[model samples]
Target: MQLIRAFLVALMLCAPAAARDLDGIRQSGQLIVCANKNAMPISGIGDRPGFQMEIAQEIAKELGVRLSVEWIWAGYQARYTDCDLMLGVARDPKPASFLRYLQALTDVQVILVFAGPPRDVAFEDLSDKVVAVPSASLAHFKLLEIGADPRVAYKSEVAILQAIESGELDAGVVSSVALDWYRHDRPGAALFALSTDILDVTSHYPLTIALRHTDALDEADYHEIAAKMRDDGRLQAILARYGQTLSAEFDNPYARVPDEISEPDSVSVRKDIVEELEDLARRNREELEQSAK
Candidate 1:
């Protein structure tokens, strides 16, 4: 035990110090945020850098510093990088061991989407209609419990939406972010995002700004900044450009934080972004089939 303790102590002493806390970061005149290059509508490297980047830029301006991005393929692994900020993190009472949930920025929910005439979809209305949800998902299980008989053939939100648009499916439950991206891609689509008030299971969660567990700034400081942005309409203005929605702060006891601190999954943060577009081309096949029929 003594040998193990000594080895751990030696390693700690040999390791580099934690990245600068808020004061030091401000002194450096730069705030470094870790981002995924391919995660569109959240974080991206293309001409249209995602909303997360835009939000970070606003935050940096508020802090009176320049924003610098360290682009990575996966954002969960940012804990190991020399970055201080990570955007679009799910808010949790207990954040990951390596990070702190700074503040809730936006609302992410599983919305009911369908085409035809624009009208709100009630949960009871789903019983008689065929609906689609990702296989083995909470939404799927809930639909089964309600006797909705949800279809799970579609693997991605985009595919499910396309199926609905092609009249191959009736309705779908998918990420609001995915819905926004879909709408952005198909501006003239008749699809509508209906009720987000799904019961039983949690259909909504808040997206937050996560700060590395460093000395730079405490949770309250970041919270104040977020509150200011929310009050002044800057946050909403930024999200509006990307079709995102702001969420009021709320408590969530059942939600789990990232506990796998040793080796977090590289795919964790990028999964939603990837799944949103996966099998999107399948819609083309559906279109051809519809034409044949």
Candidate 2:
């Protein structure tokens, strides 16, 4: 009897963590999401809710679980959190670090210029020009690398655009996603004005949904659900607002992942990066003209 008791205790001690499956989530009735704080247009803090939060809410609705967000900056210890999901995660393979990626969410790119500029503002062409850049953004680094004159710093992408509109800055560089949010919210903004000039430089990359698996067991089934959404074009609709349409190739990194686990989707593989932004701007302009009637 003592030997049997010892065996049972060992079995209990050796038990593995649980996998987040359909039935498990149904029983819990809650899906906790972890998101980076202040990532505007994706995940925001305080009053402004990012679109990724909306995406998480929709995922919870699909899973029949109540949605909740656990906000954290980069270095939050995962051992202390109960977060089961995350959205808009950059596809990095450096280290799993206790997280599993389910599927690619959308593409991300930097848009250098908006409409109304007299000339195209390329990085090599910034002589005698005042360019507004969101502090610490990819564009900011690139501007410095090219030795741009008078690089004005702004707190946020929205602030950069506002400075341009207020005539405090001649032009600004911002991410396509934030610009998409701005055009959607303020469709009547001064894109129709003649001052918005074109700046040169554009690129894109993929963003994925990161999963904090409760278990190390392969999550093929959970991934299938996200794949279903991608195949049905539902995900495309969400990304299209920001001029991001998923690549038709669907080069899924989650499948057949090797042991190395590096930034598989490292560089922005997008070819027609600026064209997508222009198309969005053109469509919005036409809609604005119609609404003016």
lDDT scores of the candidates, listed in order:
0.70, 0.59
For all candidates, the clash counts are 4, 6
Poorest 10 consecutive residues by lDDT, candidate 1: 253-262
Highest TM-score model number:
2
lDDT per residue as tens, model 2, 180-219: 6677767766632221233333445556667776344445
Q: TM-score of every model?
A: 0.59, 0.60
In candidate 1 the C-alpha lDDT for residue 107 amounts to: 68
Estimate, for each residue in 72-171, the C-alpha lDDT of model 1 and write its tens digit: 6645456346688886677665555667775556667777888888876667777777888767666787778778868987645777888999988888
Q: Model 2 scores what on Cα lDDT?
A: 0.59
Position 132, candidate 1: lDDT: 89
TM-score of decoy 2: 0.60
What RMSD value applies to candidate 1? 15.3
Among these predictions, the greatest lDDT belongs to 1
